[model samples]
Target: MSRESITPNGLNPDRETIQLGKLTVPRLFIGLWQLSSTGWGTTSVTRVRREMRRHVEAGYNAFADHYGTAEQIFGGFRSTLPDPKVVVGATKWCVFAQIDITRSVVQAAINERKEKMAYDRVDLLQFHWQDYSDRQYMDALEYLQEFKNSGDITELGLVNFDAARTDEICTQFPGLIVSNQVQFSLIDTRPLDGMGDVCNKHGIKLLTYGTLCGGFLSEKWLGEPQPDEYGGPMTPSQRKYLDVILGAWGTWPLFQSLLQTLQAIGGRHGHRSISNIATRWILDHDFVGCVLVGSRLGLTEHIDDNDRAYGFRLTPEDNAEIEKVLEKSKGRELVRVLGDCGAEYRRGGGHE
Candidate 1:
């Protein structure tokens, strides 16, 4: 579809957005979870700044990050954008509260992060509860809630909360949570096991990661051996997760067939890649405010290709064809085998 004929659903949707409380963010937000980390490359601040300029020029307004240095990366150059409108950012606090998450300590961190990011307030500070057993969870939530209520944060939410626990939190603090980040993607539909319906009922939207399954669902991985050889001596989180999906989806040959079907339909739509099809398929699944597609900073930029997803919408026939392929192979039941959509943190005791 031509840009002239298509309607943009987001900022440029050439970027994208969703309602995070009162704040609107790009539909396809730039994820910085791996940025500033060495696994991908030596991220130079200069290069990262340039990437942000290009990304903003493309219309993507949100950046989600986790590590301490993440704030530093975006914080270093706060005045480069167009009137603080280029990007709306979100970062996570890994739920490692020390005994009591003293308000002074929490406020100090927020101030530091806010000052570094060059914003009066953070658009969102995602709360990550590593373990439900920790008593500090309450203290942390209290302070986080205080921040949200006082407008230090545009909004506050959780990452990877189980359905049961999510219900408990909402009951404890009514009408406060605007969203929850989860692992919703082609391979992980675990949230649909009643969580999404409940979210709709209670007014919470879901921000999903792994939507592309670490490139496994793309054309490149369709017919390959699933890369059991592991990219290096130290396996990556995404690669390992893809390996598991491959196991669940049967073998490489079956996945290849699935990819081919997507390719055929995608080709019909001028996309020619399964990744675009997979992304479009999720847009209307309900309660999905947006999907988190990561940025490798220096590795690759798919911003232009990602824009393809917005110009078109999938059809019933399109979904049926995709499902037919999915039926042939095993679907993602890893959440069942592992736990709820994001119950991995509690089970594995946080990321390795």
Candidate 2:
């Protein structure tokens, strides 16, 4: 499709677009981790497929998935869409198991992911290593680079990788890595400390998640009482982010204050929702290439609110309002406690 005719109905005019190798994707990607059914909640295949089609129709051409059943689920959904080639898919290869880092093993893994996703090639293949102590991940990347050169993968990306390690990888490989997926939000700004600079220096972009803090940053939780117990009717994401809010972010009262501030700012901008303001804040960051928004598929819909993020820009006064509250918050110290962008998962704590 020509660039002029590529715009979809209801697409926000101000939404930025970026080029990932040869694939051009919107600044916001539809996240499919919730489709795994292990964390968010139970999802029906029909509902998930319908939601996927809706996102693509809305011009959210790029989608993110993981190794497990997410790729398969996305594959099934993609089959139902018209001209699936227009939709860009991204999946990860988890390097947790100890396996021989041979070229054959790596090629087989890549082939398996492609076959499972019903695609000859993936737009982006992101690598996630649970234990950085192991050196097998480097070998895996070496093999992936070969595939990238041969056109099996369009781009290579990393998940939860720190600044120092990312720089080392870039230095050793030159221009192999194009992007890094990390958690970046109002509550978690660890990426700004070092990762941002390294990515900027090396021409690596960032795809950020957890910007909404698993719905904790939404209007639904504003002024609401904190849950007394950890487990209840809350989804796993909600339970996990709640911990960050209480632990890293600070007291519920302070969070409520932040929420009100966002609401007021959003009100000035066509009465946007809290989630819209939160997502727009992340998109405003220079290092961020895209913000991954978790979709519950047919379970719920936020297409309209999400589109609002691109409708208006935040002013300096608005940023100052958020900063004023953050100044008194413990988010900075929380970054230290959490270690780095993907440190929580590596250390087996925090929300992964």
Candidate 3:
């Protein structure tokens, strides 16, 4: 579809909508984690606006960001856009018992982020709880509920909450968690093992990440020559992640076989790229509402590429072969390795 022809429809869902107290975000949300201050990454206001405009044109309306720097970027971009309502934005509140974020501190963060986004009410405010054990979980949740009640946030959500803890929050708070973001890809199917049933019962959606295994799922790594290292001297996060997949999944030979099958599937769907198959493989799973694909803004242009995903199905034979390879591979506690969903931010980070 041409950029001029896209509309705010199911073909490309609206940025936000209300389903009970929960807000249904766009099928694809633009994530700005790279814009975070913790990283040395940089983005100009023009580049940011152009990227956002392209997303809007491609039928994505919702955006995800936790960085204060991202807030300022969106603020500046929003000023340039003709209509910002097409954009529904999400920011986060950290469960600061680990960091000692007081209710006042939480409120201050919300107010400050709202000021930066120039939106009085955030469409969604996802809570990032670092440690689950502290009884302060209740306290942090209550503050979030209050944030929702006070109109500072439109919907309540969680990032990387474990199944058991997420269930407790669901029952105790009644309507607090509309969704939870977790790392789930064909490569990582734990969410299906436990959380899927739980979320199905509660009418909660699972927003997944790492489906492409940081671009390892793409064809570039398929039959191509191997680099000296995963990143090939300063590897992108996605490339390094494919290395993790190699360690856990199998040798390059096994991965290449899986790629062959994925290529066949993509061919059947008229998507010839390794990435098309890799992304479609996960999108076919149950209980996944959306998958967060990363973009480097000015550095990359895969938004249109992502459109190739989800246009076809992987056959039972295909799934069985993929599973066979996975079953043969080394399995480690990825959570322990990478930290829970956004746990890379808490403390120093285990991967480095």
The model with the greatest lDDT is 2
Task: Quote the lDDT for 349 in model 1.
Answer: 68
Supply the global lDDT for candidate 2: 0.83
Instruction: Residues 241-302, candidate 2: write the lDDT tens digits.
Output: 88898877788898899999999999999899999899888888777889999988778878
- Determine which window of 10 residues in candidate 2 has minimal summed lDDT: 1-10
In model 2, which runs have C-alpha deviations exceeding 4 angstroms?
Answer: 1-7, 349-352
**lDDT tens per residue, model 1, 1-352:** 1111112233443444678788787677777777645765565777877776677666765778756466767755446543564467887766543455689877887787687777888778777777678767767778878887787888887888878777778778777788788887656678878778768877888888788876666877666564655554322556656665666656667767877888888988875468888887776677887788877775678877787777777778987887786666656566577677677667766651
- lDDT (tens digit, per residue) of candidate 3 on 38-71: 2324667678767777776777667777654777
- Which candidate leads the pack in TM-score? 2
User: If ranked by TM-score, best first, what sequence of candidates would result?
Assistant: 2, 1, 3
lDDT of each candidate versus the true structure: 0.71, 0.83, 0.66
Our model 1 lands, by Cα RMSD against the true structure, at: 5.0
What TM-scores do the predictions have?
A: 0.88, 0.93, 0.83
